[model samples]
Target: MDLAEMIKILDRQLTTEGRTIHVDKAKEHMRIEQRTSGQGVSLSLSELLRRYHEDGEEALNQTILAIDRGLHAMASAPHLKGKESKIFPVIRSASFPDHTSDGRRLITSAHTAETKIFYALDLGDACRLIDDQFLDQEGLDEQSLIELASFNLSALPIKIKKDVVKNNTFYFIHTNDGFDASRILNRKLVSDMQAKAHGDLTVAIPHQDVLIFGDVVNPEGYDILAQMTMKFYTSGTIRITMLPFIIEKGKLEPIFIMANKRPMPGKSKR
Candidate 1:
């Protein structure tokens, strides 16, 4: 019963049934398959502890492919994107925009299938043509992408200078739902031909992909919680994904999370 022992038997069957765990219905009961050798599929543990004892563990701990052997140990590591520029660990997908109650910011999907996973440092070949157009492998050119993902030919240091900020603040952890949850959780939505081809005309708000994990001397924010604990509670789902970067001067960046702070080494043995 992987997925961290079916979230410890669905957090002891939702603490003996008083009911409360609903991280988006445990991320909508988790699921993912994608395979053909690009390496995918894993996380069974008797069907995720019988669906987390029939549903709970925050409703089911959604995505990262529902953690089955931690998404086949991150799609089978050692792919090392051509072996260099280390600091791997990724997995992303995000979007924003969908507001109202007077602020009006359309473009909705009611939150596009969220997903997340940090840690980076692979500048060396800018992800080899998007991992050869979706992991068919082979692509790192520019001088073998600086002899394999740069930054001193990789031993993990693509560029993670500004240190330590555990759980720095990547949250979609919702439940209140009365609206104005910080402007509908930081909304977003552009696409009027991509916001007038980048001029960003106006009125298209609602953007919720937060992460405030502080550092440089406890700048604040901290809540590295990957929680799950359930067992029969019904109607559950939880999903929060935001992994895409490019915004130079307002912080809110991406990649770089393991200074060996620990807890990732085993990924619960696949």
Candidate 2:
């Protein structure tokens, strides 16, 4: 099915459940609002359409079910004080909203030029980004929140799958647990990868569900990584960045890759 047909079907499905859907064709997304509470979310159709093309309508239906659960969870999320363990850092595109629709600032920190770190409370099937008002209600300071979130992130299990292309090794973390990219915040993991790298250590979080580590020894490796990252970034439901980073001494510096030239580090914005 095409995007228009998909949007029409989704609109009918959600409206029957009391949502007000506004199609923004220019942006290729639908802004869905809860008619009773005014809480809303922007759902991008690009990735959904891509999924429909690859996995057929059954996969699309499953994704829509997940979206519905996520929306319901957002509308009725719980308090934060006793749920400290569920709080974790999430990696989002730098272009993500910094404030709620009602103007409450979101809790976030600087990461790199292409991405930012935001804190969220995991709600099993979904998560809600922690805002300034939520922090105030919990009486938690930003530093303490970050510390707790980081601790929670580190406590999660690490899983990696290895692949090789033209003698260069690539390690991928794709747990499909919605925090795969957030694992980048786990310092020990990156440090361990760096220690084992035969050459320059490169990292890419092209989306929320994938984290890629490259052991680059030749120029061709950078080219392959660039193509691979672009593919994932374009098809991702929640894209982070197409640009990869060089991890040096615990600092992440974004790099620019040309087809046949050396990758150059871009100036750090954070």
Candidate 3:
């Protein structure tokens, strides 16, 4: 079927398959964020249908193709930016409340939400949280859904400005006012780093942020990474340093860093 017809068919099939739909016309962009049970699927479907109705199939197709190309490019070049560029994020994930059921946050209450978040996928990382199989069952083929699963965070890209190393840990800094680093990039970077070098390829997204990736093997290395990260904070190099987290079992498990004499260990988690 053509794009418009395909969109219409998909919409009807989505409801028949027992899915809910939501749309945010207030925002100029059409992003398919996280899907819990099934929120983002129809929300995105409706938005894409709306676009097809308004701009016609050709325009919608062009946008899809552009996003696909952008995602392919982002796999290698993380800092890619500027006009004609797209934040080709690859996966939809469930965002969690950072606290207990009472809504008290373990970190900050600012981000505790029962919403969906999207991330660019690195080919190396496995997608969890959402059931891709469900999409395929909803009359959408696997390949097309895979290509379109990513959110177009922005056409303006995020750039990495600088990086430094101390105690063999690499500290990467992305350009300010750009898209925040997603989970997909985090996985690829850490996996690639551990492969190239050694030690646990750890990470932390503090604020908008100062993206820190490193291999902290010993207490001294953690000390150095934490110290410099704090110094950067004092220097205004980054805004806030959220507690760093590690990747395990293809997921981000958050942890707090305590200084000197064997920092509190984040429980071994998946």
lDDT of 3 by residue, 204-242 (tens): 554333466766665555566666656554333113344
**80, model 1: CA deviation in Å?**
49
Which candidate, 2 or 3, has the higher lDDT?
2
Question: Which runs of model 2 end up more than 4 angstroms from their true locations?
Answer: 24-29, 44-51, 54-59, 266-270
Could you give candidate 2's per-residue lDDT for residues 8-104 as a string of tens digits? 8888667646678899898898888877767787777887888889868885776667668667876784888789999999999999999987788
TM-score for predicted model 1 compared with the true structure: 0.23
TM-score of each: 0.23, 0.90, 0.39
lDDT of 1 by residue, 143-216 (tens): 44333322332232111112233423221322222111122222131121122222111111122212211121
Q: What's every prediction's RMSD, in angstroms?
A: 19.8, 3.5, 16.0
After superposition, the stretches of candidate 1 with alpha carbons farther than 4 Å from their true spots are 1-92, 95-175, 178-236, 242-248, 259-270
Q: Sorted by lDDT, highest first, which candidate order results?
A: 2, 3, 1
Count the clashes in each prediction. 37, 0, 4
Model 2 scores a C-alpha lDDT of 0.86
